[model samples]
Target: MMLTNAVLCLLIGYVGSHGRQEMFSVLVCIQTVVFVCCETVLYDAGLYRWQLFIITCVIAAYTFQRLHLSKKLPLRLSCFCMSLYLSKATIVLIEHFVFHPNKVPVYSYVTILFLVFMIIRIFVTEFDTNAHSFTGHLGLLCVSVIVNANPLIYVLSSYIFMTESAASDIAGLCSMVCGVLIIIAQSIHVPEDLRVRYTGVLGIFLGLVFIVFRPNLTPTLYSVFQWIEVFSVISFVIVMVTDSVTQFLQIMLCSAVLGLCPGFRAAIMLYPEDNIPVSGVLLFMLSSCIITCIILCFIKAQHLKHTFEKRFIKMSTMLAVVSMVAVISDISTRENHQMFLTLPSLKLILCANLVISICLKLLALRQIGELLPLTEPKDDKEVPYLPTIGNIATFISFVMICLMAPTSSFYHDVWCCGASLVLVCLQKDMRIFSSLREDNQTTATKITSLVILVTATLYRSDIWNYNSSWMFARGVTEIILVLFSIPNCYILWGLLYDNVLVLNEQIVIFTLPLNFPLILYSSSYTGWALAAAGIVSSIWMMFAKFALQPYHDDY
Candidate 1:
């Protein structure tokens, strides 16, 4: 009954969501139905977790029939389904044997919700319709599943020593056999042509350790073994899925797996009965040490200092950033403002990281700009300055909105200026703009405008502290402005990408008026009337000047 309700709620929520693909929606519904029905039938029949495991394998085969994934469907299903079911079984086994709470927490529903969200995020952000890329995303999804499933595996195995002697022996022997079979299957699936042949052998070795350590499983030992199995499964899947070999995907895979270990360890520590004395810190350090060793070996073998070295450094730096953020969050929650203030080191580190990240990103963007092929200078009359006019109109509308908005919290209007700057910077014909440049005048205008904008950003918080009543008014005005500008921005953004020629650098001159208005307007009827006038005129000018123009490439 509990399972049925959870599954039903999940399905209903999935169906009602906006912008979902039909195939994805159907796949989710079918999977949920199968999961609920299988649990219901198997539980009523008094089946062991092992029987449900076999049932999971059957479901995996059925899923492949529905989805029709190419290349090593059995192996993919085995890794995916086994990890999923093992976690499920581990939860059941622990509840039955170790600890039982009176009430099942609402957290299962939360878990399902999270699972759905992750599926959507992965599909939206990463997956494309291309088959190879889809396979890579699928492989990533499987790795995530394995990583998330590890905590349950640890909890189930943590107290193996405390179980009834005969039960422990039976469970140990069964686990040993299961591990061996998994390892053997993983080994066989490896292609013989690859020079890097030891992945399967390494998996086999990890499985053997799990088998050997089953008799005296401590919390620490169990966690170690579980991580090994989890990483081994990920490695095997990466090997089988050819498309997951790119540096970016590999970084994501490794980070997701290694990054969550602290959280998993901390969760166990948080529970009273489930509290394990093992240190999350030590576990993290161990994982890092192992990763570092592996990376060193790979670097030595590949000898791509330009590629691997840079990526590894970036990843390691990001990992440190994550750790710092975690520490700062932990400290802030304790309400120790004095300690936080005293820590100049933390502040310095954060500032340095911020500056470094910004510089690196700008460098990357500049490199990309350099690589873009130069296009032939088409006739200026081909595509009119329709986009530029639209942008100018929107900029005027935003300025009006800023003036009408409350004096407090008005710095958010700088976002409009930033948006305008982005449009200017992205112009492909950077050299063409210099022809329109009027000696030192444009440069002076740009510098003056930039300094003023930066000053506003630096002191906006303090400025808001002087008055609190404007807060609600500020939100209302901003929303109105956003609604007004969104259509205009969309049109202008499309125009920029359409390879049109226009005065790019002159957009920077508009920054002056964008920043100058904060000094002039009161949040009164007169201010609002002027704002309304600006909005109407700009939108009217946009449509009147550009709407009928055949500026679009297709037209």
Candidate 2:
């Protein structure tokens, strides 16, 4: 009964909320919370079979009516919803009579049926039918199914054979990279208006990598070198193919597989545990539903039919082969499970770098979208300073990274913060000063400030051994110094560059102030309040500088 409610909620939330993906996400989160709470309560009370049937019927009826009455909803969607509800209700009835069970099994045939319906709904409602032939659609469907099923197949095959070999890992990684590269290559062929939307592909890929891949320093370094070699060859070859619809089909197949693989893996992993953990199950459902919806939304939003060159497909194939062989050779000769758990700091650094890269890419995509004439301001002096969806997303990603860093850190808080500040200052100043003929007052000021910051960072051990009064004052001074210097450096950098900080950098600049309350007072509430203030102030600054008054003639 609980699973049925989850399915109904997922469908209604997805199909009923047109042009409101955020609302759908919220609905899913709320429904999952409510259902989990209710189920926990009901489990203790011992839900009866009759009670389950009654509940399923009521939920099913409500879902059917809700979907049916949505005026803008397609007729096919209505039918699909009805069929899904009826199927669930039928499964409950059969369980009542034959199995005499209180609830359907989580991994039962009914669940498989629900997944099939969900996938078909995604394909029918989200796929661009006018963009490709029937054969193309079928090919994509097959690829999605295979990709989704791959995890389960591997798990099952493990019982019969050794499925966890380096060879298999290499093959899987090669396949994943091939799919990603193909999608990126295909994005080049999409209409200009729709091209920016493909940037979300990077987000999807990074999100999956975060969830599924465990980083190791050695393999990562090796993979990078191999990827560069393969990328160069593929780029040369893909530039030579003729543009055609068939190539588009191949690209679509790769996109579908890449987009759906994460969700499918999450869902499949849900089946293995002997006891169902409510929190785990709820989280899995939420993430999977959200990913699927986001991907579908991207697909449905594109209207133009674009064809890719045939060389893209050939290049993708050759790249896959090359990557596979390279990975296999690298992995095969190495001792099993060696270096897997080594270099914990390296892994954290890699993950942090990946997050920053994705955020930056998202920012770039937002800039591209903003450049479109439709979104461009009519007045030369006016710029759009209001935060867009992309800006909000980038901010959220940045904040998450900031919050996550402290938890993952291996060094002292003070040293870590100081080092980060120094790095940011140096990185920005080096770039700004590189083209300058000689150091000016501004440059001299920054260099001196950096030296002071570095001296304070290195004096951490000495400060700790001082008398309590002196130690407290010194700590406060250091915190004040960092809080001051970090923003000053960024502001100076921004002024020197004659450009506003990008959303991600703005996040860094603003949130740097939180170190005061966070380190000196150790108050989370204070930290949060300062962070919120910083964000709001950053937005207001952007609005004031660009929207209210012209920052520059060209801008």
Best by TM-score: 2
lDDT of 2: 0.40
Query: Cα deviation of 11 in candidate 2 (Å)?
Result: 83
Clashes of each: 0, 0
Clashing pairs in 1: none
Candidate 1 per-residue C-alpha lDDT over 303-382 given as tens digits, one digit per residue, 9 for 90 to 100: 32235334544444554554465455435443333444323223223333333333333333443533422122348655
**Which portions of model 2 miss their true places by more than 4 Å?**
1-261, 267-283, 292-387, 406-555
> On a 0 to 100 scale, what is the lDDT of residue 547 in model 2?
44
Q: Give Cα-based local distance difference scores for all models.
A: 0.40, 0.40
What are the TM-scores, per candidate, against the unseen true structure? Answer: 0.21, 0.27
Model 2's number of clashes is 0
lDDT string, candidate 2, 101-137, tens digits: 5454555444434444544443333444344543354
